[model samples]
Target: MTRCLRRIAALALVLCPLAAAAPAAAQDSAAAEALFNRGLADMEAGRYETGCEAIAESHRIEPKLGALFTLAICESRSGRIAAAFTHFGEYLAQVDQLTPEQKSRQGERPKVARQEHDKLARLVPELSLALPPGAPAGTVVKRDGRVVDSAALGAGVPAEPGEHVVSTQAPGGPVWETRIQLAQGEKKRVELQVKDTSAPPAGGLSGRRAAMVVAGGVGAAGLVIGGITGALTLGKKSVVEEHCGSGIGVSDETACDQAGMDAADSASTTGLVSTIGFGVGLAGLGAAAVLYLTEPTQREPTAGATSRRIRAGVLAAGPQGVVLGASGVW
Candidate 1:
């Protein structure tokens, strides 16, 4: 009698948990079925948001292929292209795992899912994000609050069409956030930049002022060279006069000796150099004036400032002749 009682108690202990769980299981199944029916009704009535929510819950509880299909269709109709595409793929994969009889019972669902998936492929938007050239090694990027994989950087990755907030964080850098709106079939490329706030405070010469100084220095150097060369040219004329007869009407080349010819050549060379120096001096001074006039009144770093460029060029008519030297700041 004692052994019989012990065996009966053990059996009762084992069966009690099963009996208790049966009601919970039944309730869950009933709830899942109710949610599934309600989801289908809501979807039929064009209430995609509510329908998708209910159907997603039902699928979570019961994991039916039909519920997944309904959720996918609901998401697609609601313009959640990425979600729909993923669910359709999942539905198709699960359908593939079913028995042949079960598969046949799926009717045209597999075919329809494939078509929808392929079609969504073209309608889905992609976001291509890349860090700038000098981004820190441990930079972290997030899209809509989800961490993005490192390997996907600079590559076109799938994204849902809608307003999205992208954020990035780097060591010793401020958290950068950008708002982007994507449309169907649109591919956007974005470069993530980390703003450096570590620059020295505004206490030194501004970039434009510094540029003006440099240009002015160049102009001064050119002017000094022109003046020096001009003097040398006059000295060469005196040398030519001394070598050749200084009579006012002496125009014949044969009257002058080889020394005079050499002196004349030297004078021509000095004159060319002097002209070139003057041209350079004027161009540099003009560039300096432009830079000074265009400079901002406040002393600020050039970072993030409006982009400006200075161009300088020498137009040469021949090897020894520079026709024009031009400079501009724009």
Candidate 2:
């Protein structure tokens, strides 16, 4: 009886933990299922980004085969070709592990995943980095701030279609950088070289200087507007005086007519506009002066420096106003 009781107690201990885990596992599965349904609904509603995120989370939680396939489709629709391709490959790789019945139930899905994987492989862009001859040893390369493996330096690596920043650094040498734009299925190569450190850094206008240029342009525009409106106000004043009084050099208030009232109103409107323009002109000028005077006299160039020239000026003047222009070379 004692031995039977001890065996019973040991079995109870193990069974207790399993029983406790059953409910938690059920709850997790229910949550994953709910997320999967919501993700499907979101994708159907054209919310691809949110749907992808939800489906991805569901896969992370439960890792169902259906969820994996759905995630690949969601990522593909969301324009994340690389992720879609990788997930599709993963799905295909795991298909053989499923039971025969499970494989039969997943009819045509494996075929579809294979087709998508191949299609995306062609759409993804590639980038290759090459070092100049006699480049120093231990040259490190980076793409979009992520370190690139030395073995990948000469080989074309897949990249998403967009702008990418590539930089290279050598031990005890200045860093060199470049920007490249890639389109779908495009291949690009960048040659890396050591930066010339002997010359002074060539960073164009500082931020404060750029702001000053904008403010100065605005001030110039306001002054021109005030001048034009002021002249119009004066012309309207002449008309008002001619029609409001009996005649020239006369001040008979009772002689004013509807035409004189209209002229006076016009003059007042133009005068207000002129005042506002002058106020803006003065404020903009003040801001520009403050920005310029408080600006630092010098600026340090960033790592992997590039030469830039920023030019801003009044490009053209016409009867209406002056056209301001700003251009930069990088």
Candidate 3:
């Protein structure tokens, strides 16, 4: 009696967990059955798209061969013979597990699937692309902006019948491109050749050339500056001639003499500045021209304003203060 009681206790312990899980399993089976029935009803109601989706979902929840069969048939009828053929092959692999009764019931299934696979194979078009001999190594091929796997290049890739574009980089290297329209059951081949895109024409105005052009402008401006300073020097020389050269007799004349000496001193400084500016302008312009002719590539653009301040005109020396030359921008 003790052994019997122990056995009974172990049996109860085992059955308790099973009893608890029974409800959940039953609920899941009920849900799967509901989905399967819904799929069938949807197909009968002319909603094949929803029917196939539901059947696939049901198979996902509970992977039964019956649901797979239904999904495969639905896919084929919906004009996706490729998808149908794929599922059919999958089904045949495991269909042997079914009992004799199940096998007898699903007759002509394998035959129909084989026929569809062969037919879809013939109808699907393929595209083959080749990169020309000069194509850069590691060139990435793309289809409609999505990069193609390097492993798959130069091989026939199955594609839907439609227009397709093939292109590659455009700067520095050659531009390789082609646009193709594929027809059903067609095998198309495309080879892209690179066009020369490296060098500019022998003589083109570039950055260095542009700098030379600006240098030329600077030279002309420098010349103008020199010319203006030259005029100021001559004006100061004239002042000296009028006062000191003509002996000073009147009080105003004496003031003019002192002014003349100051002017002469200022003329020397201005003349030197003008000479330096003129020489710097000519030498700088010549150097820029040489660089423009010799540079391998155009230099970057220089952007800014240049300014110079020149104080030139003579001012009257007054009793209150000693006046400096004219002050302004040049």
| Cα TM-score of candidate 1 | 0.57
Rate residue 153 of model 3 by lDDT: 73
Q: What is candidate 2's lDDT per residue for 1-330, written digit by digit as tens? A: 999999999999999999999999999999999999999999989899999999999999899889999999998998888678888989998998988999999989998998999999999887788877877788788888999998888788878788888887877666777777889999777666665345234575655667888888888888888889999999987787778766444568646577778878888887887877766666567667756655433222233556555554456543444455556664
Top-scoring candidate (TM-score): 1
Per-residue alpha-carbon lDDT of candidate 3 for residues 12-82, written as tens digits (9 for 90 to 100): 99999999999998888888889989998897787899998888888888888788888888876776654
Candidate ranking under TM-score, highest first, comes to 1, 2, 3
What C-alpha lDDT do the candidate models reach, one value each?
0.80, 0.79, 0.68
Best candidate, lDDT:
1
Q: After best superposition, candidate 1 residue 227: deviation in angstroms? A: 34
lDDT of 1 at 158: 78
Q: Superposing all C-alpha atoms, what RMSD in Å does each candidate have to the true structure?
A: 11.4, 16.5, 17.5
Question: Runs in model 3 with CA error above 4 Å?
Answer: 96-102, 124-330
Clashing pairs in 1: none
lDDT score, candidate 1: 0.80
